[model samples]
Target: MTSTPRSPHLPLPAAALLLAVLLTACGNQPAVPDWQANAHGAAERATAADLAGNDRVARQEWARARAEVARTGRPELLARVELMRCAVRLASLEGGDCPAFAPLRQDATAQEQAYADYLGGRLAPEQAALLPAAQRAAATGAVAASAMAEMADPLSRLVAAGAAVQAGRATPAVLALASDTAAAQGWSRPLRAWLRLRAEQARAAGDAPLAAQLERQIAIVETAGQPAR
Candidate 1:
């Protein structure tokens, strides 16, 4: 019986060199952190839940997003998380003192800056007032005109409408923006409620006809979720 010859093996050092080359060729990419992924995913889910009028679910998701981002120890990401946290709080009408967005101001994109500025104007007039008069005026004007509508999320739109009305700048366009938004988001509990509040604001502003019209629209939206007879 003859033994089969085996291929010659590399010496240990040579084998180690080859292994190192192979590993180096593999690129050794870092894995994405679970916390970062979870936070981003939660933030998206929270937005969807909010649009669907699922406040309970959205609230949970927003909290989870903030918590997950906190675990990542990334200050920039934390600022975004805080922005979302404040946005959600404003939605709940518990904005309390305006959130200081200055920490992220330098790093935020233009759109983010606009959103934060708009919210600051509404929730913390004093903070917004610190801006140059022209800039402060522009923020209120933009929100009042609903010029931010194209850039704003639905929740932001609701807040914008309230701010616009409060500023006595709820123009026809602003009213239309709010009316159309509530009509489109009829499923959203908060927006519908906001619409009702807007109707009252309209009445107080001496737009009786508009208030009546909005009240009727609110009635329709309220019945949308009910089981058909």
Candidate 2:
């Protein structure tokens, strides 16, 4: 051969630098869209509108929240949150009295309490205890229904009485009806609130002993229902 063999050229560093540039470019590309963020923002705005006593805005936000929760597969949690949202709207409508809000809050609270009891292993015993009565009532057909209707009449009377009590025009009959309803409902928060109102009415009407008795009943119910704290 006339010439010496040529040395081979190595391009490893150049190839590595090219790969690094490509990777960096890919990493710097635009991010995907964030639907959740937008939905949440809409929810916040809706909440603000609700707080400002705008029912229309509140409803709009509820729809958005529902849609987002459906997409996210968290409908149960979202439903509870929606209850709080509704509660806020109701409070705004009622001039800041939570008790004056719609019954949705009470129903939601009952559900939440039931769930908590289940999680804490406290619901089984209660359910077991109630099963016998439930089964007996179920077997009674129209009789059970009639009894329930009869029971409901008293509750309705109590509700009416509670209204009168709030207006400072309650009588002994009204107080008795309210007390009975409260007891029958197992001192549920809503019922307890009614009982408190009745007690207030009693106090306003110069029946301190009755008011004290109602207060004691309320305390007992509250203590019994309270989660271990």
Candidate 3:
């Protein structure tokens, strides 16, 4: 007599029980990590402060946010926080310390490195003053051009606009882009004020045309939020 072959499948009930066990197990997974939550929370607070015209508080919050993730030992998150800090510093007319980001640069991706280069270039007059003058100028010019063309971050864009003005690369197109951004983003108040001050200084130094152009750009940006007629 031939022996009966055993069925290769589990009974329907057993299959259903297995699935339920899996579903329950997945439902009980761990919550989000503390570092991630803290970092996000800090960033939101910083953004809110920036929008409220509180520059110092915004920068402080941004720095705190970066520190939150720095404790996690995650390079990508750390790089992102560094970039945010750099953006805040740049927008405030203080620029950031280039050397402060050297550690982040080590593990950064190509895009992140580009951002660092741009910030360094933008702050070249102060941060990179020790470099040979010719080398500094070349690097600054190259990074400025690349950043203006490639940067997508809104805060970074504002910073780039201010940098362009400072470097005498303030073409109409550049000014137009900066003006439009400043008008569209209410958080740009501090940046706009800084640009106005820069323009005034230029005027006092006898660059009347440059000053007038910058002032026009500032006027356009400052009036950008007016109610429609």
Alpha-carbon RMSD to native, per candidate = 16.3, 24.1, 15.8
Which prediction has more favorable TM-score, 1 or 3?
1
lDDT by residue (tens digit), candidate 3, 44-92: 6776676456678877877777787778777755765666555555555
Cand. 1 Cα-lDDT: 0.53
Candidate 3 weakest lDDT stretch, 10 residues: 12-21
Model 2 stretches astray by more than 4 angstroms: 1-155, 162-169, 227-229
- By lDDT, rank the candidates, best first: 3, 1, 2
- What is the lDDT of every predicted structure here? 0.53, 0.42, 0.54
> lDDT per residue, candidate 2, 70-98, as tens digits?
56454443444443343333222222122
Best by lDDT: 3
Candidate 3, overall lDDT? 0.54
TM-score, every prediction? 0.59, 0.31, 0.54
Compare candidates 1 and 3 on lDDT and give the better one. Answer: 3
Candidate 1 vs 2: which has more TM-score: 1
lDDT of 1 at 171: 65
Give the true-structure RMSD of model 2: 24.1
How many clashes show up per model? 0, 0, 0
The model with the greatest TM-score is 1
